[model samples]
Target: MIDVYLFSGFLGSGKTTLLKHMIGQVKAQGLKPAVFMNELGQTNFDSDSVDDGVPLKELLDGCICCSGSEKSEAQIQTLLAEETFDVLMIETTGAAHPVEALDAIFSPLFAERLNFKGIITVADSKRWLSRDELSPQIRSLFLEQIRHADLILANKMDLLTEGEQAKTIFELQSLNPAAQIIQTVHSKVPFKQLEKTTAKKSDDVVKAPVAKLNLDTRVLRFEAGVKRERFEEWLRTLPDTVYRIKGYVPLEGDKYPHAFQYAYGMAQWLPEYMKMQPQIVVIGEGLEGVELP
Candidate 1:
């Protein structure tokens, strides 16, 4: 039986970071793993950053919990039929609802062959307390992502004060009393805590919540290599309305393409060898007429 793990969290909550770490751990154990990354727009960065030789599939243009469900189910069936992997890791888009994701995975087609392992949610401590500033719908999305998690990682603890950390934990507990919470910096959670024997079904999660976020995505493509320093400077000064910025950027004088991720005013880059056109996908609410340098 294939053990399956679902990694769910709000955008910029470090789901991709934790998923990469978990994939590395699984590889270290000599176990084969397959990844299904659910991305909101056509552009994908996390899939490219995955270094494992394991088969990776991207469910793009929608979240797996909603519009992408059919495609996601199909991908799972295809993997089960054509590939061999000891485990499967699914990284859902930040806006994805756990209930809908569970419903899609636990469908009759996947019932017998797959063993649901764990639902891990990563929470940004700073973002946690700033929910009130976001639109009501987005705030609900954040809370819903935490509601059904088996393990909730209170990440980015370094940015919080002692009093803020206490309140963050208290709020998280109030939202998800059943989840096991672990505080960490940079979403670094113990690998052993991720493996599990039991799983929860659609009924186990709350009823499927409708997504009301008016998210807009802008895709920018650059055919030529861009100067790393100039790009970095522009990324550092992105508008506050931009919640997520991800893409494959070809840097000048570099043989390999660079993968970039920008969230909450922080930018990260790593050498990525994925053979894809260079483009960036910026996602956020109220992004109309937004220009990027």
Candidate 2:
């Protein structure tokens, strides 16, 4: 049986950063690790950040928590047969709920061959402390992500003051007294602590929170290469309602396609070699019919 680790957190909570560190640690320990990533939008950007050594299976277009809308049984089966990794790490969309993600991951067909390792959640210290600043849906989603976690990495500690840090701990512990809470900077938590074998097996003890996201997605495809300046400008000027923008773009001056990732007003561009069409997927609230230049 392969050990499966589930990573869940709110949007832009630093799941990718933590996963990259954990992947390296797992390799140093002489264990082969594979990653299964689920992105909320159709276009992907974080996949480029994953190391080339690790085998990755990406589930796109929807959250895995929703049963019919986002199924992973076929993908899981494919991974189990084709990949040789002893450990499989699943990184769900930052907005995913633990309960639903867990259900989708341990589909009835593959449960016997898979061991339920545990759920690791990364919480942004600044975001958690400023709940009043978020929308009702986001605030509820963030709280639910932590409630069922086996380990909670309260990340971005560097941005918090001593007093704010203390309160962040108090708030997380209040919601998930059972989870091991660790303070981390840039989502860095020791991998040894993450390798803990304790797994939660009850789906009945506590009720999982239900969240309905009223978000929309748009995919912009470009047949020709785009100017880096214009692409960066669009990313920097995205409306506040936009949550994430990702995909690959063939830059006018670059030898390879450039992967674009934008969230929380931050834009990141990296060279991508993957043989995929140049397209961008924008996900956000009130984004229907929003034109992109």
* Best of the candidates, lDDT: 1
Candidates' lDDT values, in order? 0.82, 0.79
TM-score of 1: 0.89
- Candidate 2, 35-108: lDDT as tens digits: 88888776566787688879888888777777522356677778888878888888998767777777766677
Per-model TM values vs. the true structure: 0.89, 0.84
Residue pairs clashing, model 1: none
Model 2's TM-score against the true structure = 0.84
RMSD of 2: 3.0
- Which residue pairs of candidate 2 clash? 9-94
Q: How high is the lDDT of residue 271 in model 2?
A: 75
Task: Supply candidate 1's per-residue lDDT for 213.
Answer: 79
Off by over 4 Å in 2: 68-70, 203-205, 221-237, 248-258, 269-279
Question: What is the Cα-based lDDT of residue 53 in candidate 2?
Answer: 79
lDDT string for model 1 (49-87, tens) is 588577888888887977788888988888778888898
